[model samples]
Structure formats: C-alpha cells, structure tokens
Target: MTENIAESIVEAINLTKTFHPKKMPAVVALNNISLSVRAGELTALVGPDGAGKTTFLRLICGLMDADEGSLRVGGMDVTADEQAVQDILSYMPQKFGLYEDLTIAENMTLYAELHGVPQNVRQERFARLLDMTGLAAFTGRLAGKLSGGMKQKLGLACTLVRSPKLLILDEPTVGVDPLSRRELWEILQTLTKQEHLSVLVSTAYMDEAALCQTVHVLNHGRILASGTPEELRHIADGRCCDIAPTSTMPTRMLQSHLLDDPGITDAVPVCGKVHFITRKAGGGVAFLSKYPELPKATPSEERLEDAFMILLKEDEEKRSSNIQPPSQREGDREAVVGVSKVGREGSIDCNVEGNASADTDEAIVDITVRDLVKNFGDFTAVSHTSFDVHRGEVFGLLGPNGAGKTTTFRMLCGLLPLTSGKLSVAGVDLRTARTEARRNIGYVAQKFSLYSQLTVYENLRFYGGTYGIPARELQQRIREVMEEFDLTDRADHVAGELPGGYKQRLSMAAALIHRPKILFLDEPTSGIDPLARRSFWQQIAHLSAKGTTIIITTHFMDEAEYCDRMMIQDHGEMLVLGSPSEIRERMHMPDADMNAIFIAIVEQARAELAKEGRKPA
Candidate 1:
C-alpha cells in the first residue's frame, strides 16, 4: 500500500561470504560490506563479475544467509523473517527465470497467483504490466518465442504483478537489444515515480548507473567506491581526454604502446577513437611526441570509466607499493583525467541503411553478396540480399529478432551452407575457398562458445592452439592482449566467473587470435553494460585501424555511429546501407539523430505497407 512508506527499505551490516574452491583454500565473495538502500529511490549496484553484486542481491531477497552480519528488506530481517520479506519484496535475478513453455499472459497469471494477488487486481495489474512492458499485443505469444529484450520485459511484468514495495533487479538488461533496453528502463522509471517503489538494480551499464539516484561500485566483494556518477567522477581529478584519432590503427597502437608507460593511467578504444586518462595534463601530448608516428595529440577530460580505471589503478598501485596506502596516493591521482568530460547519453534505437553516394572508391569491398537467397523447408530465411562491407570499416547488420540477420551471419561465417548466390570475403569466394575465407575472418557468435569452465588464459590458449597460432607468437600475443585490455589480473579467473565485459573481451581475443584480416561480430556487445560496450568498441576501433575489416551485426543503433558504413536487413531483404548521416538523410529528416530517424523510417515503412494493402512480413 502507498499509505505506509518507510525511509530505509533495505539495510545491510558487515555482510561477508566465503567459499572454498576445489584446489584453492578459500574465496571471499563479500568482505565486510555494509550498505543501506532507501525507499522511493532507484539505487544502482555497479560492479564487474565476482564483485558479489548478485550475492548481495540474494542476501537482501532472503534467498541466502550471509556468513557474517545481517540484511533487512523493507525493515523486515531477510534471514529471520524470510517468508515475510519475500512477500514484501520482488527479486528478479539476472536470468529472470521465465517459463519458456508458457505464453506471456499465462506466465504473468501464474506469477500473480503465486504472489496471492487478488483476482480483481490480477487482471488490472496484468494489463498494466503488459502495457508498461510493451507486451500487450503479444500476450498470446509463447514466452520462448520472444526476443531477448522482450523476454526481459515479460519477466519484469511478472515480477511487478503483485506490486511489491521493494524491487530488486539483477542485471535485467543483459543481452537485450537497444530498443528493448530503453523500453525497459522507461518502464522502470515510470514505475518508480508513479508507484513510489524502492528499487535496487544491479547493472554493468555505466549509462544506466548515471540514471540512478545513487550508485555503489562493488569490486571483489567490497565497495570500491560509492556515490552518484558525478561524485565518483569527481575523484578522477580532471585528467581524462577523448582522443579522436585521425587514423584508427595508429591510435590503437599509440594506446597499446602507452600501456606500460606510467604516464598513461588508462587507455581504451572508443567510437572510432582511443580514450585515455593520464596522471597529468599534457601527458598524452608528451607521450604522442615520443612516437612521431602518432598524429598531433589532443587533451580532454576524464570520464566515469576513466575515473573507475584510475581508482582500479590506484587500488593496484597501493597493493604493489608496500609503503603507500590507496588513500595516500588519492591526491596525487586526484586529477579528473579529462580535457573536459561527460558521458555521452541519448536514445539507443538509432540505425538504418546508408544512402551516401559520396566517393565509394576508398571502400575496400571485403564481403560481397549479390542476389543471395537461402531457404529452409517452407521458409525463406534470406532472399535477394546484397551488401558490401568495406575494408577496415565497422559495418552493422541490424533487424528485429527472427528477421534473418542471424541466418545471414551464419552463412557468411560458412557455418551454414548457402542456398544460392555469391558470397565472398577478402576477395575470395567463400564457396570455393572456405578454409581461406575462414582463416581471414574472426567471429564472435551470439551465444558464447568459449570453454566456460577453464581459466581465461587456458581458454585463450585453447583457441590459439586450435587456430594454429605459433607457440611463441601466441604467448606474446596473449600477454600483450592481457596487459592492453587490463585483463592480466583476470588471466587465472575462471572464464565463467569473468564479468560480462571481461567475458566479451576474452571472446574477442580468442576470435582474433590468428589475426584474421576480417572480423565478424554477431551482437558482440549484447549483454554487457554501456561502459563495457564503449570499452569493447574501443578495441574494435583499434582492430579496424589496423586495416582489419569489421562486419558487426547489432540491435543497438547507437553503436551504428561507430560504423563507417552499415546495412539494415528486414524480413530477409536489404532495406538500406550507408553511413549514419546518409541513413538519417534517407529518412528525409532534417538534423534528426539516428534514433529518431530509425523510428521514423520503420514506422513509415510499416505505414506504406498498410496503405498499399500489402501485409508486412
């Protein structure tokens, strides 16, 4: 009931968790962490994997007991009054626990009954949840048939069926498409404001973190830092710069070259540029001057990630510098590494095909498909498709779920046999030179395919060996990647244990182990947080600069901006292709950004089909 409002809904005191591994003696998941979450506020639990974020969520939800200390949800002790807390709170785990066999409506109804919601409220809440989640039109649709984003919405709707006072969401947006993620967030914002709900959401996305009223950064079961995004960024001391490169390869090389140099605190690849944080102003310029090969350097301010990186680095240095405590060096590292910085934020569903007629001569045609057609029994997955991915360019292939993008991607990777037409990669016909084509292309599939049980190093080694990487070269490459990607510390961490961001980085490393001439990424940044996605794109930009052709297919339109060129496929047909500007222009929108253009174009297409009395497929 909205009548009763408590100040502190969730509170924890000196929470601790420990477990022993098979060979290892012990591992502490949470180490003496204490926190308080207030009512009618959205709090973000931000962290990488093994940070005990999930464990903390579970403890507050009464799913488990902490080895030390206590937790209470809505003023009820979670451990002492587990059932009471469960009734008052709703916990949506990272997985969301959707029943695939059930239809959307059935799933909601089932959860409603479980929560003992009154029959009268059940129908009303069900309708509201569906509308909020944009699932009203497809309540009859099987839950298994929904897309990643849609399924997440359905899960959220089910969790909200009973209108619990406290809501705990664990990585709810993982693997969801950009449009779906935005939609979900919109619903969350509305629910929190309208219902005055107290929400504790854990996420990997920094952009989402920025949306919260408060944030707590968890690392190795401890709060590394806690505050609002601005508060945390203030600790950076003004020392980060977004370095837009005139050339991608040189920029990436410059970033890697500076990794061991103490002057550069953190360097990550971003949308077509390398972003770096330094210990002091002009450090980037100074570093670039040392490498005459690099273009004239630019100085900028540190971002949230920059601050996070600086903090992580400070933590590392403190551990290594026996005489120095982390706090002691805080002032020395106090510069907020930035020429001037702020997180780039906006809508996400901005994408479409390009229409730029400008100089096509520079485009290196890596993959050429003409009149491509693929069909399964009684169904055509792809039909009359054509597109070209230029050399050293990030290309995006976008469409809704079941829109044939995956099928097309599979055929391009030579994982599936093409029904007809020509498909060539790196100037070689895939049909005739499958081995050579495969050799020249690196691919990270939608479903993670790495050895989950193995350590990061072991998995990389395994992939490198499989790809025929020379032992010495492989070792060197592995070491370079580990250090450059800041994954050296996680080299021994179990692959499955690595956070979503690290897992993506590891997968990319394995895919590129052989240094393929062309890279194919299928929804590479799907499940991770915005910060991780940005970092991952930085790596991609690095590769693209090296003349490595990149063909990426993603549902995140905002990501399309990083692409030199992109193509949109809908219902097994090529709808558009060109750069972001060109695609926006094609929609006849003046100065509208990608998201607006995308919505306009899709809606226009749908309306046109309706007007023509042609049923849209």
Candidate 2:
C-alpha cells in the first residue's frame, strides 16, 4: 500500500476530558489542550504524574473519547473514523500486554497475524524489528523468561508488526534501565529519520523529553508550554545555577531549605551539589544573597527540567489546596520522629554488625555481602559480589536490566536464597536465622507492593501486624506514620486509587511501621514526577540522618548522585564502586555526569567481553 503523509500527522484542538467519580469532585484530566505532532519528527509529551499525558494519548487513539474539541490522526477525525485512524497508527500504552507464555518470535508472529500482516512481509518486518531492538539472538527465549528491558523491546516490536504512519508511546521507558531506555529512543529516532515516521511519546525523564523535536509541557490537564526544547530551555536561561551547600548541611536538606524560599523556583541535587532555579531570569544571584548560609552561585546552562520545574512551581502557587507540599509540612522535619526503636541487641551480635537504631549514636557497618553469589540452575545471577553498607549511609546499587543488581538485592533482602556467600543484616546471618534478621529490615519494593484493595490506614495496620507489632503499639505507630508521612488526608482512601506520590508515601509508611534499622528501597522514585522526587529525597534524607542504613536501586542516573556511595554491576559482575566524585575521577573525566559515566563503563565492559568472545547473559 502506498502512503500519504500530512505535515501534521496528529492534531488536537481544545481537547478536554474529565472524570467524575460518584461521590467525589470531578477531575479535569485534559482541559482544552491543543497540540500538533509534526510529520517525520519526534514529539514528546512532558509532565508529572497525573498530568493527563495518558488521558491525552488515549483520546488520540480513540480508546476513549474526549468530552470536547477535535482530534485528527493522519488528517482523519478520530471520533468519526476511530478504526481507520487506529489502522494507521500504533498506540503503546504504559502496560502493553504481551503474552508471556509465547516465545519472542511466536509473540511477533501472533501480533502480525492479528494485524493481518501477510506471510510475505512478516519475516522481513520481524527481522527488521529484532535487529533494530538488538533482540535478534533472543528470538527463541520465552517472553516470561526475558528481562524487563527485553520484554519492553519485544512489546515494541509487536506494536510495530505492521508499520504505522504515526507511533504513539506512553512512557515506554518508564521502568526500563538506562541502557535499554537509550536503545528504545535510538529505535524511535531511527524510525523518524530513516522511515519518515512521526513519533509521539510521553516521558517522565527530562533528558528523554529534551531529545524531542517538539515538546508539550503538561500540568493539571493543560498545556503549560509548547515549543522546541531550546525554547523551553530558555525559560530558565539566566535563572539556573549550581550552589554548593555549606559543609554543615546535607545536599538534600539544603534542597528542602531552599525550596522554602519565595525567590527560588526549584532546587535539586546534581553531582552532590544543589542545582537550583530562581524565580526570574536574573534572580539566582539576588536570591543567593538572602541565604547567607549558601555559597556564591556558579551559573549553569539551563535545561528542560529546570524549565518544567519553574512552570510547575508557578502553577502550584496560583492554585490553593488543603494538602501542603511535603517540604512545607511541619510534622516530618526531624529525622528522629515518633518511631520507637527496636534494640538490635537481641538480634545479630557479631562484630560485623552496627547500623545505629533510632535511639543509638554509634555508626557502624549495617550490612555485609561477602562473596555473594546467586544462581538459577545454570545461570549465575550474581557472581561473587560483595559490599558493605554502613549505618546512616545512603548506598546506591545500579545496573542495566538483567545486570544482576536485582538478584543481588533479593539476596540481601533475604527474599531469595543465595547460592553461596556470607550475608548479614544488622549482624544477623541471612543464610540462617532469616526470621530474626528480617525484624531489623524494612523493604520498599520497586512497584507499589501494598494491598491496593485496602485503605491506606488498613495497609499500614496490616504491615505493622505482619511485623509483629502489638495491637497497642501498632495503632500508635500507624498514627505516627500517618502524621509523619503526611498521609492523614489519604488514610481512608483506597491504596490503588491514590495518586503516584501518595501511593509512594503509603508504601514508605508501611515499610517504616516496624522501624527497621536497614531500609531497602528498590527504585522507590521510578515513575514519579520531579516535585514528588524532590519531596521523596527529602524524606530519604531524614531517614538517613536518623541512622538508617539505606540500600536503594534505581534507574535514575541523576538520583545516583544522592548516594554517599554507589556500585555499578552488570552481567553478574561488579564494574565500579565509589562515591560520585570518586567514580568521576576513576573515569578520568572530572565533569562527566552520571549518565555519561554509566554508559561509558557499561559499554567498555561489554566491549571487553566481546573481545574475549563472550556475550553478556
């Protein structure tokens, strides 16, 4: 079939969608938003969680109808010819359901048959997609057996079984690792450049959105700004700068302190320093003068993230709400809040133990993974990995998909059995006496693991009971957690229905119910927006300050900077381990950002393996 391409492949004019729950106030998901996806160009929808990016994409795909305005896909009105529009476009939702039972090739064939892709063209397309996604050799693997990144790749391939004029992806990189995320974008860019395909994608990562030719910044179901990234960047041109915090204050605490300043727009940790944006174009220097505690500002180039934050901050100021930002909430200021400490004295007694309990002042090694190894029959998941997590230290464990980081974490958390190694938490041996050791550990999983059907308060109570808290103590702890985490308003709300930020807070609250000495946060801030992330980090800062040993795994390179120490492992092997500065120095590039450093290390490792005629598992 021949093709006809319009200058604007997709267009929306004054589009709006609202949801009205039976007993609640209506939510305006999209409010008269207008945008255009230019033909043969990469377009991005940038927004925080609950910003209506998904709602807008669904409207374009005709999966749902907008309450008002017009949407045209490939110059065809979606409402009038939804099927035709869909036939010429592919919409990849956040959770693209790929049959896990089938092999990768089988899944591709199934999608091809469903799309009526004739046998003649099926092989060619499958080959092209597999090659493009770097999954050609993995065609025989079962979908369920593949890693997260591989599954996403196969999902994308299935969506493209029959090439569409326009490709719509809703946060396709949401949970994928940096390596896979980069690969996914490379595919999209090639589709736009080589095949002249128009691509529209929504992303939580500012770096990903900045790569787009056009970006529409969304907030509260409205287009806050729409322009090229350069134009958006100019929004904070003279307002952005980096300031080193005083030796006395922590970077995260400094960020929280600065956010309270009226003249400051946004403040976040960047490479262990505070990178902030001011209210006006030239307001950074003036704003710094007011805070004698802060050092002189070093001007930095603006970024799409700085611009997005400024817009969101400005918008929040115009609207009033009963719920206050976490930073402004007075209840959780102290790291050592209402939690009653559990004496680790009865737990592990080895000299190998030490994360101080909330009541203690000694900082010692909290966890030890000595020659840790995990294997699934023939596959070694974590090969002889070892690390020590000190009390009150924030340690980051990062790796690409299928890189053994998750395996290492599972072993540490005692969720999985280690094939061989000495594992210790709070000085208690993990290999034996897991039950006793678990008492001193709190784990927040990558995904929301709370009971969605239950209310927030109920979830907290359940976790407290699970942790063996007495009825009287559990009730009091629940109240304390609710107050400390600012979840009082959401206590009665169903866990599943809560927004991303609240859900995260609920998870943390549930985890903190036992007040475990070691906290394991597995990608806790994966899909949340920047504002929520800042608030989350502040909470983390508080927890760490109070002698909590935090061992976290995340896909966010920027967040790695927040770690006091971090280790990168790939293909079941340790690649590098050090603080941010130490890592940069090791790479011999003093100014290299975490992303660049990560890519370099992983690539170099893979290259060396290739030279030795071996492929990463």
Candidate 3:
C-alpha cells in the first residue's frame, strides 16, 4: 500500500455538467474538465465565484450525474456505482448543516448514525476526532454557542464520523479568522500525512491554494491551468514588478491609476509599494514608460495571484469588472473631534497628531466613539471602546470571531442602543439626532444584505424612496449610480441570482443610493475573487478621495493595508491602532507585510494570555 501512494484515487475524463432550467438558457458548469488526484495527497481547486467549483465537486460525489464524460473515484465508476463512491468520500460543503441546538456530542452521534457507523466503534472514533479538533472538552456545549472557528472545526469532526479514504472541503476557511485558518490547515496536513487521507479543498485564497501539492485554476466552467505551485508560478515569471511611488503619491491612488493601463495585468498594494504585473514578460519597463515621472519599476518575485490574473486576462470573454472613478463630492458633514490620550499601546489618541494625513484632512472628525460599551445580559460584547474617524479617511476595525466589531458597528449605525457611551456619526449626535444621522450613513454587509427577491433597479428605487429622495430625483440618481457602477446590463436581474461580484455591487449601489457622507462596510469584499476585490477597492479609493469617510471591519489582513488607519481588538479590548506604516514601525518589522504583522500581533497577544495561565480568546 505504501508503494502505491502515488496511484490515482480519482480521475475525470472529458467530464461535463450542464443545467437546463425551464425557459432559461442552459448553464454549462463543466466543459470537458479532466484532472487526476493521487492517493494520500492534497489537491486544490480554485476559481472565482460561479466558476463551477461546487458543481464539479457534486458530480464527483455522485450527488449529480454528469451529462457527459466519465469519472472514477477509488477505482469505481462514480455514475455506475454511486453508493460505492459515496462510501469512500466525505464532503463538507461551504455551509455545513450543523444542528445548532444540539450539543457537540449529540451532533456527532447523529451524524455517525446517519453515516451508518457501528455503535461499537462510535465512542473510539468520536474520541479520536474530538481530541484531534480540540473539541473534546466542549462536547457538552451546544453547537450554537461555539465560536465561528470552533463551529467549523466541529463540522469537520462530524464529517469524519466514519473515516473515508478521501475528504472534500468546499471553502472551509471562507469566513474564519487568520489564526483559526492556519490551525485548520495544520489539521488537514496531519490528516493527510499521518492518516494517509486524500484531501481536496476549494478556496478563494491563493495563499491557501499555494500550500497544496497540486493546484487547478478554473474559470467559466473550464480549467485554465493545472500544475504544482512552482510550475504554475512560472507562468508569471519575470512579469511581476514593484513601483515605489514618489513620496508625494498615495499608494492606493497610484494603484488605481496603474490598473487602467492595458499592459498592466494586475496592480495591488504590497508593503507600501504598488506591486503590479505586466501583460507580457519584459513589459514592466514599457508600462512604466507611460508614467514618466514615476520611479523605475523593480523586478519582484512572481506569485500565484499574478499567474491567476494572467490566465483569466488571456480569455477575451472575461467580463469587464472596472468601476469608473466618480466626481469629487462636496459636503460639510464634519463633527466635533473626540478627546483621548495617545502614545499608549492600547489607549485612544485624544487628539490627531499634527502632520498626519491621508487623501483628505485628518483634523476633521467624522465619527467619534467615546467610552462605548455594549453588554448582552451579563456578557460585555464591547468594553468601553473609544476611537475617532476622520473625514474622508478609510478606517478599519479588525478582530477575531466573537470580538466587538459587529457590536460596535451596530452602535455607530444607531441600529442597536449602546449600553453606555458617547457617539456621533455624520455630524449628528446619537443622543439627539439619530434619525437625521441615518439619512447620512450608508452600510454594506459582508454577505448579501439586499432584497434578494427584487430586481437591482427595484432595490435601488426602494432604498432611494426610503431615504426620502424626491420622486423625480430618485430616478435620476438611480440611473446615475447604475451607470457609474457598470450595472446597467444587470438592472433587471434578481439580486439573489446574480453572481457573487454582481451581488456585492448591487449591495453597494443600494447603500450609496442616498449619497451618504459616512459609509460602513462590514468585510465587504470577502469570498470574492482577486479581480473583483481590486475593482471594489478602486471604487472605495475613489469614494474616499471624494471626501466620503469609510469605516470597515475585515478579517483579510491584506485588505487592512488599504485603510488609512486601523485598529485591532480582541476580547472586547483594543490592542493596537495605527496606520499601516505605524503598525509596521511599532512591530519593528520594516520588511514584514501586513499579513505577517497581523499574525504576529494576534499570536503575541495569545502567547501573553497563555503565559498568564488563561485560555486564549
């Protein structure tokens, strides 16, 4: 068996899946897709939303028979012997259906019975899984009480009630925190190395995909490329370069402009520089020639994302995901600045330090939270949080699962009454003008928060009217926003049926319908592809430049780099608050990227907790 470790455990030949709904065009999910997965190895399938990843997995699991081609799992024909194939694979989907009302042990027992595990071996199997997942001590806890990471771990444990030769996970770390995500990958590695279990995972994160032994990039129901990490990265070799913008140039603003160049395939902020990819190798210098005043481009190491973008860009049928820059916004919504002490590690800065600047002036306060606190029963979700957001500045709030980000957001938006605090948003005091303040605040949630059943236009009109726009002005505003957002073609499409990127666009359109001065975005770009995420940032940068203050919460550390300043909180207390440069300086990691610095800060806090003999939050 050891000698046969490299044998193919799953193989697909000319595989195809199509859906023909009544009166609708046929949706081809897979077009002659072919791939091979070796036994006891890790493989990854990565793609943008609606790229047929879920459909492909479903076909392999025998949940849906392919319209054409053939597939074999564990040497058994999946279509010809569906049950035999299902018995050898465990599939955990994006939204694993865990019985939240039941205890961990009860949930495991139920899944064991459904999977037909023998009663005699149930206890031993459960014990092993519980121990492996660090959930043994919480068997009596209800699933609903588990944290986001713990719930995902429990779902994984339940999938292993009856061990299978292959384990399939669909974006298991989508909304999980970074620490938990790292831990989960460690668990997967242990399973594959120690138990010799073959694993297949689909992810939107290139970093995660890069860790797998094999990677397959898919789009429009077709595999664009497939190979080992090194082989795939070779596609973008010598094409990647970094442009250190002049000291006067803003990083994000420079990136937004560079993305417009036809020769530049991709542009993103990396470590205070604008890292970009050229459409062709040796074109970096040529692209830089377009911007004569900019510094010379330096060759940078190639990355999986650069390769992914090149493959997607080579396809002519790819949709144009650009968001046109908007005109400057003129408003006088600034408020009184909050007072707090500065220079203390976790204390609020009572005053804006002179010489601090972003795209706009930093002295004018837009939102202020003074001694904010929120308690649900006896549990304090937010403990005396205090901070000030400046006009036109992009401020971010980052924390682990169950942290006070959402709670603080609700208070700022006037959705939830604070237990005790002083807050002001959009020049209106919550103590006096919450109703007026609502008229000037916009919010977009991480997931689809719009009316899914309504058309895009209908949703926009609804929000416009609700915000008290005149009947005549509402239509004009709606048309203007649709054109700006490039959603004219999908105006009549139902919100729920749109692809993930379009869904996010629709949500943003609805939020901006009233032209609010303050925008609150809750992990707005999560689960989307790199292309769409960059496009979204372009729009955000444009808005910030136009003098709109943005307050957001995100788990993606890279996204945090886009903020003018950000704060990281855990266990209802602020740990660090500073600009990206300030954070790197404080950590004494001049060369460390945002992701590394974030992990170090969070892990250091965890280590301190361990040293104090307390459980890490």
Q: List the residue pairs that clash in candidate 3.
A: 340-350
lDDT (0 to 1) per candidate: 0.72, 0.82, 0.81
The root-mean-square deviation over C-alpha atoms between each candidate and the true structure, in angstroms, is: 7.3, 5.1, 5.0
**Candidate 3's TM-score:** 0.91
Which segments of candidate 1 are over 4 A away from where they belong? 1-6, 233-284, 287-310, 320-364, 374-383, 399-403, 426-441, 453-516, 529-547, 555-562, 570-576, 579-615
lDDT of 3 by residue, 460-544 (tens): 9999999999999999999988987889998988777787888888888889999999999988877777767877887787777
Where model 2 places Cα greater than 4 Å from the true spot, the runs are 1-6, 245-250, 284-295, 321-324, 328-362, 614-616
lDDT of 1 by residue, 346-456 (tens): 111123322223344445567888778899876788987876666666667776666678889888888888889999988889889898789888889876789989998
What C-alpha lDDT, on a 0 to 100 scale, does residue 616 get in candidate 3?
36
lDDT, candidate 2, 1-617, per-residue tens: 11233578987889989998644579999999888888898989988888999998888888999999999988899999989999999978889989999999999999998999999999899999999999999898899999899998899999999989989998898778888999999999989899999899998899999899999999999989988999888888788878775435555556666776777878887865788887887764444565677677788988899989988877876775554554545544554232212211112121212223343444477888888888898888888877667777788889998899988888888899889989999999988888888899899998888898899999998989988899998999999999988898878888888878888889999988999998999999887778778778877877876678889999999998777677898999989876676577778866777888898989999999999999756
Residue 536 lDDT in model 2? 87
With candidate 1 superimposed using the best TM-score fit, by how many Å does residue 208's alpha carbon deviate from the native?
A: 1.7
Q: How much is the lDDT of residue 508 in candidate 2?
A: 90
Error of 2 at 598 (Å): 0.8
What TM-scores do the predictions have? 0.78, 0.91, 0.91
